[model samples]
Target: MKIAVIDAQGAGLGKTVIKKIRKEIGLNIHITALGTNPTATSNMLKAGANHGLTGENSICNFCNTNSLDSIIGPIGIICSGGIKGEITSSISQSVFNLNCTKYIIPMQKHGIYIPGTINLKIKNIIEEIVSDIKKNIEKLS
Candidate 1:
């Protein structure tokens, strides 16, 4: 299965998510790191993503043409001018329009909050994400 992990700015969250996915999901799945900047892309690549793409155009083009099974990222990815303005409207629109399952991490930094996720930690959230991805892969298999 092919999955894209999107992130912006420092990409600290992306890197951690990639690492967990790699460690828990193994290497069978293809991971694409879609970053808003080169640094973010580089960091996620180092975390073991099979492929990496940087910038708004690259990310949008990739999402447009690729048949991704899932897209995982902070909820801000869908908001224009999010991630400290690194996420553009075009990028957000492309991701939002993708015909794939989306796993959005509710981040407080984005100033958007989900009612039930208030007490959830980032690590726990990512663990849940990995588990869900595993289930999806199993279903496809």
Candidate 2:
């Protein structure tokens, strides 16, 4: 299955998620790192994403044309001007309108809170995301 992991800023979260997905989900899944900047994309690529793209236009264009099975990233990805303005309205709109399942990580740092998820650890959240991806892959197969 093809999955895109989007991130901005330093991309530490994206890198960690990619590493966990690679280790837990194995190499069968195709991972695309969609970063707001080159550094973020490069870091996620180093973490084992099969491919990567950087910047707003590249991300928007790719998402528009590609058939992604899923998209995983911080909640900010769907919010215009999220990630300290790294996420543009076009990027948010493209990702939000994509015909694919999206796994959004709720980070309090983003200033948005989901009550039930407030105390959940990022590791646990990623595990859940990976597990769900595995299930989706199984269903497709």
Candidate 3:
């Protein structure tokens, strides 16, 4: 499966997610780190992303044409000018309009409250995503 993990700003979160994915999911799945900046992308790349891309255009291009099976990132990736208000409108539109399954970590810092996910920790969120991915992959058999 081709999974994209996107992030902006410090990208510490993206790096964390990639590390967890690498340790838990193994290398069978392909992971690409898509960041709003080169530093963000490089951070995730060091965490074990098979590939990396940066900038708004790169994100849009990938979203428009590719075989991405799933997208994993903060919920801000779906909102226009989200993620510290740095994500461009085009990036937001692309991810928001994606047809693939999305694994979003609801963040309180973003000032958007997603119902049914209140006060959950980041580690817990990643665990849930990993669990769901395993189940979904199994069912696809």
Candidate 4:
């Protein structure tokens, strides 16, 4: 399946997700890393993304008007001036408005106070996404 993994900044999370998927599913999957910066895209590329694109314009061109099979990322990717504020509003709108299946990683946006950590349950969120992907692929096949 063609999967688009969108991240505004720091592809560490994307890298982790890609690694887990590779470990769990041995099939060759198509991964598109959409990042706001080159570093983020490069990291995901190293993690096994088949292709990578950076910047708001590039991402918009890659994803706009196309109902992708799946989009995996945090809600921030759909929001303007958030985590990776560099993600242009147009790109965010395209992703949010497109008629595509989205796998939003769970994030606790409330009642959390950490000095230097996001405190998000990233592993659990990734697991949920992976499980869903497995089920969908199985049903489709």
Clashes of 1: 0
Candidate 2's TM-score: 0.97
Q: 11-59 in candidate 3: lDDT tens per residue?
A: 9889999899889889988998999999999999999999999999999
What lDDT tens digits, residue by residue, belong to model 1 across residues 1-141?
Answer: 999999998799999999999899899999999999999999999999998999989999999999999999999999999998899999999999999999999988777878988889999999999999999989988
The lDDT for every candidate, in the order shown, is 0.94, 0.94, 0.88, 0.77
All candidates' TM-scores? 0.97, 0.97, 0.94, 0.85
Candidate 4 — which pairs collide?
none
Overall local distance difference test of candidate 1: 0.94
lDDT for 135 in candidate 2 is 93
Where does candidate 3 clash, by residue pair? none
Task: Summarize candidate 2's per-residue lDDT along 6-103 as a digit string, tens digits.
Answer: 99998999999999988988999999999999999999999999999999999999999999999999999989999999999999999999999999
**Model 3 score (lDDT):** 0.88
Q: Which residue pairs clash in candidate 2?
A: none
C-alpha lDDT (0 to 100) for residue 140 of candidate 4: 76
What's the CA error at residue 138 for candidate 4, in Å?
A: 0.8
lDDT, candidate 4, 2-78, per-residue tens: 78898756777789888888888755567888988999899988888888999888888888755577888776676
The residue pairs in collision within model 1 are none
Regions of candidate 2 where Cα sits further than 4 Å from its true position: none
After superposition on all CA atoms, how large is the RMSD of candidate 4? 3.8
